[model samples]
Target: MQRKLSKATTLLFAVTAGQASAALFEVDPGPYDPAIGSFAAWYQDTHGRTLDLCLSKNVSSRVAGAPGAPSYMCSLLPEPGVFDDAEPLVFPTNFPPEAFWFTADAAIADAASGIDLTFGAAIEAAFAVEEPAEGDQISFARIRIRVDVPTIGTYTVTHPYGVEVFDVTAAEFGADGGRAINMTRDIGIGAPKTYNGALGGDIGPFLRSVNGPYAEVNPATGQLDRFIGDPNLDEPVTGSPFDTNYVRIQGPGGIDLRTNLFAISGKLSEVVRPTPVIVQRATYSRSSGEAGLSTQQDVFAMAPPPPATAQYLDSAAATVPMTEANATGNWYGQSSANATPPATVEVSADNSVAIPNSTPTTLSAPLVDVVSIQRAEYSLNSGQLTLVASSSDETEPPALTATASSGAAIGTLGGDGATKTLVTGISPTPPAKVTVTSASGGSDTEEVVLLP
Candidate 1:
């Protein structure tokens, strides 16, 4: 099948027209997106100063695998920007900063075109646990980093999540610390989240008004003071979600032993996102003569299956349809070609199609088709017929060569002289009757089917 352009197209987009132009590079995500989700960077200071620069949301799980053991599109690393190795770009702070500890899990982009443009320093910031303490408050380190590239093309690695690369200008440190200055700051996190596919969790940096922000040193606070709500301090709180950019103070609670001397700035930074999964459709069929005892209610959530027959029969296979009733088994369920609604099954034993674990099953279905192939037209040139293969790839034209037929003059076909190879020119001299082959390996005998 012809391959089509995907998310990787932009990778090779803006390249100069020359031999020195940019080249496309493919990198495997390496089992990421699901396993280790995103990370939230926070600060908890010694003097009870607390702040959540990096917001955390109560995320929910969406993927529902086979019924036996629920699985999701597991990702090994947390995020490319955090989990992956990062070079510490120094903070040009005027004060002497002290302390830093970094965190990561893998999926990050380290090098581009084999070039090690990574930075690393020390991480000294607020954390959950406490370390050595100072007198009043603890200080942590922060670094602002960004990248600079001469030509325009998709960059493999970016400090931010969504953006592929940090577009910078020649001017460095123009108020906004970008490529020339090497810094990143603003970061947006995912809003709605899931909880292992069961329930959805809510996370935000706003201090819960009941106490403080959405989080506190002790309580799971979800609070924040509104600026526009009560312009006079008496009106009701607005429905707008809490914003955290204004609450950038170093977290309190014996966080850093060093002074307030850090902040990582960069051109761009991405929100740590999780891999998304879908719940598949599955059916349990017992059309093999006899039916099982219990119905859907019999579904043994934790009970061991009936030794021999149970395990082998994955009653949980997803998305299988009841098209046709084969002499052997039922064919795919018949349905209107236009109707795409998922086919349904019953939990009733009367139909004898229910399993003990009546919880229900569905087959893994695609939200959309990625690629499809269809038979196109059949064209005959001179004495040869050709079948065209049409599929996902439609960019460049498709061309297939043909073989000539025997006893037919090479000139039999006027224009298509350039295609055929073996059976060329009037079947290698008339009297020599030969048959040509088609792509499908089918044969076509020339006009003289009669006795040559």
Candidate 2:
């Protein structure tokens, strides 16, 4: 017997035909505002730290209320207390250090009039798993553009990806006589509202023209409406594709005048465990007696918990445990002889079977040598012992510990391929022989030469 489908299913298929074809692309916004172009863009972290992403020519001149400057001037100046000026927004702070970040740039300019009339902007954002939910972490990017054109003229935007033309007419200066365009382009999983289920087929990461006053044929009413796009429907809307350039403005300036363009990335899914980061790796030989025995130490920079909730190290020799280092705020693991290369390191936020885990990383064998102790000397008057060491790898020096012949610990010191001086108390006195050991188990013992 043949079965007839419901009208809702049929309508869903019809709406799916109008799915958006554009996808978000990644671009480097460069250093916040440089002194070359009329553009300014920034990335604000959850902690309220702002980072400039483009070059700005006349940032000071485009201040609000400034003569000839647009009312919503793009200011490169960071907000006091709200913006972090000392350091840029780093990874793992706002975004998962392991997740991929995508960015895009769009600008229009007409410098033929002697003065630089540029409307350039960029976006740097990312989307990742928030755990317990898929694709829920949407780190939306703020798309800020500097509009410095005091006179009405046509401005054409061209970039490596696409180009668009905008005619700066009087109408663009809204009722308030100000030029401003802000809109958000988000669809699929983390959208504010659900569109036609399955029918819309993820038509997002693109500017939505329907949110603004742009004119488009309304699918519901079949008549031209200012709010033409329906976030609820998969119908065609007059907006810029999310990945290429900003949506084509249907109004006076062809700019979306509703909301700021905050691009969304990543797909809807449970948060995946963040990949383990191996910051440094080194191999060290055991003391002279233990020939052919070497130990490999791997220092890893652990990602913050939501994604890297738990971390572990697996190898042939033994499953090593990892712990966070208080000194460097990183995770450390070590394996000695008999352990095979290409060890697997994994992390997970959820130990249960419900959530997706982080991708396991294959750690290769260490190719560089760990630092080794070289010399030892004692100062009789000061009761001070000096230990010297050298490292083949200067970038990641091994930590060292010094001990006396009586097995009493003298002192611990960090290695920088330099001499380490430790003061021995009069009670312990100075031992005739001193032994230095590296974090990787490399050791060197030398007779202490007494000094005046």
Candidate 3:
């Protein structure tokens, strides 16, 4: 199924002026490049991390062809980290569990076997941990060079993932029909060469020690030899040039493929979130029962100021627990029973309070007349206060309205005309005031203090 696509192979990226005809090709050069995306700027933007390898050596070689044919050259640079063993290769553990290692291998297969080797530097070989084929791991890590042909805008070399080359035999190379691979080319300095399958010309085998017995060669003849029941060293080939191996391409006219430039990045940990604040029912209970028929009773409740200190206006008038009293006509009034439950009281705990951090403060008592302030609620968000003015005798309850001091605004009155709401922007520092007025012209003023 693996066939070297023709140079006319369409590029994955659109062809720009003086750019390579193809964008990505396949090749199995060796272990997954530890420094993946080292030269890819786009890689950094997408993966959020950079490759681990560093560039060691970069050199340019010019190939002169027959007069007027075409002048071209490419750079011979090793893949990042190929040369420096001091820095061990480390794969990212952050990758998805199912992520597999991918690489590109270089080779020229049987030219006469209907397989094409014309795609100058496209991917030729690869191995994946999850690859279905159970092939030898030895041939998986082969070192190939980079071939950057500037003129035609093509760099024939290995990339991470792509289609695999067709399988064939070493017999094609005059050896036993062993494992087949797509051979990578070299950036020759002393001597120059062109690509011809094992049939007639030099079919470049990976020069670096990483690839052993895989299209292995006779160093003496530089010709590819077959696997003679011998396996490559358990480890990659060692030493200097080995350390600097890079991805390379072999164009027919001797053009070089330049490695593209790019970067890598990653996150350390997750962010922590904050907790929410909750307002609970007011802390209060009925203290005394209303006197039978027409007498008032003392209302008592603990105002549990929030730890953060708060300014609140509380009243027990409209909220006093009420009961039906027996008479010529049953009348609704404050409960005679002392154990009646009280309604919730709201408190506004504005942060701008004048009291010292450790000081505990309480609001002033309301102006008491015929009607008494029964229950009060304060809204923390709006700094609004609602007070209930109540009378012991429901039939004669006073009609009440509220007035505010400086920086305060009055809201609606209750249906019974005994409850009033006041809004204020005054800081708790100076304390705000509200006066409750009865329809009969009687009035009482109360001081609102915010606690710390």
Candidate 4:
């Protein structure tokens, strides 16, 4: 018996881009410390302030002296140092380190000093991808905005996604003489969560009506008497579910921090290369009667640059077979073309088992396939023709190539999915027709029809 499976394309509209290089600081994941508990991961800003994400229950002694420490948390200025003799907080178990990841950028100074003193920072994390036995593959992520402010003032932190303004007060400051205001969201693979997946706890720079000494600014009227403190003020914030850019601060505050966590299931087949590719794991079961069957598995990947050919590798590189029933095995394959989505890569696995004194049985199914070019537009003006192709993958748009009817290459665009535009200057008006091809081997061609 033989079988084959293909994944349906999922349309996701969003922009995905790379980050700028800067100084990065990382703490060595040494032996787990009881005092600090365990440092699962960390993100450090340009100013040297470190935010540690803990896996264990105890708070780091470095920040133990600070009042009202948080447990099972990632916050500012926490590091791995001397052990705190404090009792450890009871934390949930069975958490996997691979399920959580973090990365951040340096702080951008919005104000040098005074009431308008502020520094903007960005932090990001990658959570585990939830791939069910049936249904669509869902990726999960967390985005956090942490602001540290000294002195009472109104400030705003702006990133590629959205903008947030806060009126700080002395009472809001932490023991470090600074207030850490946080806004967080847990987003899934589909549309932006917006108001969904909001995790709010005790720690807060909660929504409070702005009063004297701090008046909110109104954009429409330029009124300084505008009252702030609406928790839902920045509703439906826009941001890619996978990545983030540097944050900028404005007004009278310092240390604005933004953090985002994304879910990664596999590595890109082109462009940037990530080490130790992330793979899928599952349990395989067989009845006792088929215990003596010999099995073989083969894995292959296909990605954009149309007419994408299948790239196959040894099953050992992609899978660790289940030696026994109900046991788990790891399976790796290429699932992404870049950091963000509109997943352009497709992965398939073929498993064959030889039955004792019988013909072998084979099963094939796509492991990954979730993005494609959903739409394309062409326009001509002043002898210049432009082609814009939109993809369903929001994270990382697959590379696209445009060709003229004369078989001449027009241009190719990729990287950011938000902006996949190709422009070319032609002599005799528009070409008779144009074809756009995606890296995933999908193509769309349309005849040029000019207005009379």
| lDDT tens per residue, model 3, 1-452 | 12243332222211111211111111222334334311111100010111111121111122233443321111111133332212332223212111111122232333333222322221112123422122311111112222212123222433221222222323332342222233443211111011011111111111212332223333334654322111112223211111222322333345333222111111111111111112222222222236434333332222111223333333443343312121101112222222122222323332113112222323233323344555444555555565655433343444576656663545434655334433434333333666666653345567654433
Alpha-carbon lDDT of model 2: 0.35
Per-residue lDDT tens digits for candidate 1, residues 1-452, read: 01122222122212121110000001112222211121122222111112222222111132233443322111111233333212222221111122221211111122232222332222223212222122112222222333333332233332211112333332432432223324322111112111111011111111112111121121123532111111111111111112111111111132111111111211001222211111222222111124422111011111111110111112233222232121111122221122111222221111112122222222222221111111111222343332222211122112222333433332222222122323232322233233433222123333323222
Q: What is the TM-score of each candidate against the true structure?
A: 0.19, 0.23, 0.17, 0.24
Which 10 consecutive residues of model 3 have the lowest summed lDDT? 41-50
Residue 188 in candidate 4 has what lDDT?
A: 31
Candidate closest to the true structure, highest lDDT = 2
Tell me, what's the RMSD of every candidate? 23.8, 24.8, 31.8, 22.5
- How many steric clashes does model 4 contain? 24
Native-to-model Cα distance after best TM-score fit, residue 365 in candidate 4, in Å: 15
lDDT of 3: 0.27
For model 4, the stretches where C-alpha displacement exceeds 4 angstroms are 1-55, 61-64, 67-186, 189-450
Model 1 stretches astray by more than 4 angstroms: 1-102, 105-116, 119-145, 148-163, 173-452
- Root-mean-square deviation of candidate 3: 31.8
Question: 3 or 4, which is superior by TM-score?
Answer: 4
The Cα error of candidate 3 at residue 388, in Å, is: 2.8
lDDT per model vs. reference: 0.21, 0.35, 0.27, 0.32
Report the error of model 4 at residue 14, Å.
11
